[model samples]
Target chain A: MNANIPSEVLPILLILIGTIFSLLSAIGLVRLPDVYTRSHAASKSTTLGVLFILVGTFLFFLLEEHYFSIRLFLGIFFVFLTAPVAAHVLVRSAYRSNVALAEESVQDDLKDFIHTDSKKTKDAEVNDTD
Target chain B: MIEIMLICSLIFLTLSIIAIMYRLVKGPSASDRVQALDTLGINIISGVAVFSVLMRSTGFFEVILLIGILSFIGTIAFARYLERGVVIERKHPK
Candidate 1:
């Protein structure tokens, strides 16, 4: 909110926003009771945080150094591409491995689809237990 | 002023990384460790960004990309291993 030295402060402010989100995700990761909840926090919040930091850095370099970085742009793109997929793959494996849900969580929307024996095909079961 | 803020950002990033490490070390399950590693990677990326800004350099840009690639691949490999019991599944020739 300090606006005195107005022009360059925006980049730093954005970086602060990113670091704060990272702090938020770290807290969530530590405090969440279950793996699913922890994955949620780890994936989403930190992705946004990293995005903000990269964008802010790109802006800073552009404004102050007169440099355009293709690499930074690619970093942004790669994080966006991979963060959710990694989290998804990780959580799916967690579920497949029989990790239990937290006691506090009441509703399991995927229960019928994921755990029902009759609903699963023969090959699906093979792949699942393989 | 810019230096002070970037330094502060780095401090916060370091603190976050430490907290994530707690989970990494104490996490009860394999997936928990994977998640922690992913989060740690993201934090390291930002940390590197802030450090580069502090140093007023563009050299670490590739470091950021490298970390991202490595982290993503590591997470996927860990997940596959956890789920399937092997990172690479070999086909049985019929």
Candidate 2:
């Protein structure tokens, strides 16, 4: 196989950008003050990083016209589907468990859910016995 | 030249791993540590992908698959535990 720098250049650039983004995400994970914010860093940046890096890999192998380039594509596909779903599940679970957030967390919408649900359950019991 | 770039990226990834380790060790809460570990798994998956490219082999893809499934399971388990503080089924109240 003949070496082609131009064909590989874009992939290299992509990988470099991905590496930087991933590093930034890791830093954010450390610096973010609460679990909710840290989940933002862990989920969003890392997802983007993996996407860019996988694109890099896909381009690198596809340029070479290798048969196994299919695997990279598959990896990219799986990451895209799973990353955000996992993040959502984790965050919802955290909220359900009443994980404390920083005082600066300007909103408390879930408090309403907790209250409304409890009231619904109590009303159900009253109706059942009446 | 490609090998050198790959090595440099690998080093950056390692540094990210170190930062993640610091977070894991110093995270103020269990939730924080769990999130860090989740990030760690993703990083390791990408690192393996890089190595597979550098070696011109596809064997590492299987490892990526394994890591992906295991990490997903682990995250769910941790989420369940965080939500209820238990990993097993609760006995029915008599």
Residue B56 accuracy (lDDT) in model 1: 88
Residue-wise C-alpha lDDT for candidate 1, range A76-107, written one tens digit per residue: 89999999999999999999887888999989
DockQ by candidate, in order:
0.92, 0.63
DockQ of 2: 0.63
Lowest summed lDDT across 10 adjacent residues in model 2 chain B is found at: B85-94
For model 1, how does the per-residue alpha-carbon lDDT over B1-94 read when each residue is reduced to its tens digit? 6788888889889999999999999999888988899899889999999999899899999999999999999999999999878998876634
Q: Once model 2 is optimally superposed onto the true structure by TM-score, how far is the C-alpha of residue B6 displaced, in angstroms? A: 1.6
Off by over 4 Å in 1: A1-5, A117-130
What lDDT score goes with residue A9 in model 2?
84
Residue A73 of model 2 has an lDDT of 68
- How many clashes (backbone N, Cα, C below 3 Å) per candidate? 0, 0
Residue B68, model 1, lDDT: 96
